[model samples]
Target: MTGTPRLDDPHAFIRAHTALMAPPMVPEVELHLAVETVAIWEQTEEALGEMGLPPPFWAFAWAGGQALARYCLDNPAIVSGLRVLDFAAGGAVSGIAAMKAGAATVEACELDAFAIAAIETNAQANGVALTTRLGDLVGTDDGWDVVLAGDVFYEAEPARLIGGWLETLNARGATVLIGDPGRSFLPQDRLERLAEYTVPVTRDLEDREVRQAKVWKYR
Candidate 1:
């Protein structure tokens, strides 16, 4: 489903290695999370060999996504009966939350094969239906009623592209929302704050046990 090289028995590998759990902030949505970060990283490297593997981002519920899911669940009216897009969807937590909150349709996009598998497996585990697309659709105006992106502004160029794209989408009347844990690349000046949360996270992965994440609406 992604441009990343396909792994042999990817779904089985994820099922064998991860544990089904819910993010602390959004207990209503379940995800297959890595029990330990290091092991999954090593396994992906070994499995992919010379080509190596992308970081197993899908194996964790990032602080931003957790907070966004909590907000969506708490305010279902934002997504009820609407078509939703989850961009750069890792674990698909936001997409799944939108579905659970009564979205008419949910779609997710990712460029990592492992993440694609995780998204599908996690969606099935939660009994939610989702449509997934590979690669970035940053420039496309797909006419979604709502667009969700979480924990994505951690890079220089990508954050800039997404910030500009969100503005374009917002101008077209789409409700664009972004979730971030104050990553260095986040374009704070371009967004309006919506909500905030103290989210639990894997210490080893995030360098802390909890993070101050925020939800922002693209204005």
Candidate 2:
């Protein structure tokens, strides 16, 4: 972690390693995205001399995020004038969308230092405002009127923790929305379908080039 390029200057690292690309489903927003998964992951791991780091999810516009961003853009009423939190906000996609849609406040929660930097960079690129907190925020509800998460159900442990938090928030009358694309851990039974979208994705990360993702309101 000492003097690692990603740690030393995340904004520069992102610019060097990735290109700015517009997600096909959410054309209005652009992000610094990885062109290929393996090469970028390998290079970063080799530079840091560590292998346990998770994939660079913050570099890509995931299917779930695309669906959520599109929904927020098309239906500004959901976030307009509301305090919104983009849970596990990778590159601040949905949060940026919420801000663009006239959200009163937008914040992102991410534990990874690299991801936190990426979100700020991406937010600036899109002329959106974003405040990032460094930690897991599943246990705290700060009266957010809208809580949106994208592609967070892929892993089991995180899925369990975040799912429970969302449920609690829903019970408290906060509008909770999840953007999921057939992830194995998504709690489908507990969600009410809101919208579905055909999101362009990389085959290296998913089974298909385009995934049909759904936005669900926690119920």
Candidate 3:
């Protein structure tokens, strides 16, 4: 806890044993996920540069999360002192970024206990405070000023449910935002594009050369 990097420091801590870079989060935001599971990454096709896949899954950060974090950092007015809820907070990158950018508090929800542990550890490494909740998104009822989701609409069932939740949140006057790099179920028509970025993705994960992720404001 003494010298850990945070999400706002602009430094990267890719390894678990090293000091974290950036005040919002550690540099190692990517996680290895099992294909059969609901985790973030599908699988790795090529070996990453100095990045290791520990065990059965790859713990990695998606481009959309990175883009959202960068966006929040660049535009502090969007999140300063607001109550933020990071739905499906994989790797806790976006939540940390919100806190670093001056959000009053952040709550991260995920169904996987492993992800919850990862979020807690990463938050500690980055010297950020966050509340981790373990549960499915369908039952989340707490009202928040903002809800942030990243690359979650890859599957059919999950996408449908998540989209409905976003709509509900929007109806409740909670600003809903998603960071999507063109997943199959991305509802581009239902949301307005706030920003887009050409994110470097591995061919091992997908066939595309790069993922063009967009930050969308839910309508």
Q: After superposition, how far is residue 209 of candidate 3 from its true place, in Å?
A: 4.4
Model 2 — which ten-residue stretch has the worst lDDT? 46-55
Candidates 1 and 3: which is better by lDDT? 1
Off by over 4 Å in 3: 1-58
Q: Order of candidates by TM-score, top first?
A: 1, 2, 3
Backbone clashes in model 2, listed as residue pairs: none
Model 3 CA lDDT for position 60: 51
Error of 2 at 206 (Å): 0.6
lDDT of each residue in 1-219, candidate 2, tens digit only? 344355467788777888888888877898988887878777765654453445577888889988999999999999999999999898888899999999999999887777888899899899888889988898998999999999989899989998998999999998998999999999999889999998888888786798999999976
- The 0-to-1 C-alpha lDDT of every candidate, in the order given, reads 0.87, 0.87, 0.68
Query: All candidates' TM-scores?
Result: 0.93, 0.93, 0.75
Candidate no. 3 TM-score: 0.75
Model 3: C-alpha RMSD to truth?
8.5
Higher-TM-score candidate among 2 and 3? 2
lDDT of 3: 0.68
Q: Write the per-residue lDDT of candidate 1 for residues 126-205, one digit (tens) a residue.
A: 99999988787989988999999898889899888988898899998999888899999988876789999999888888
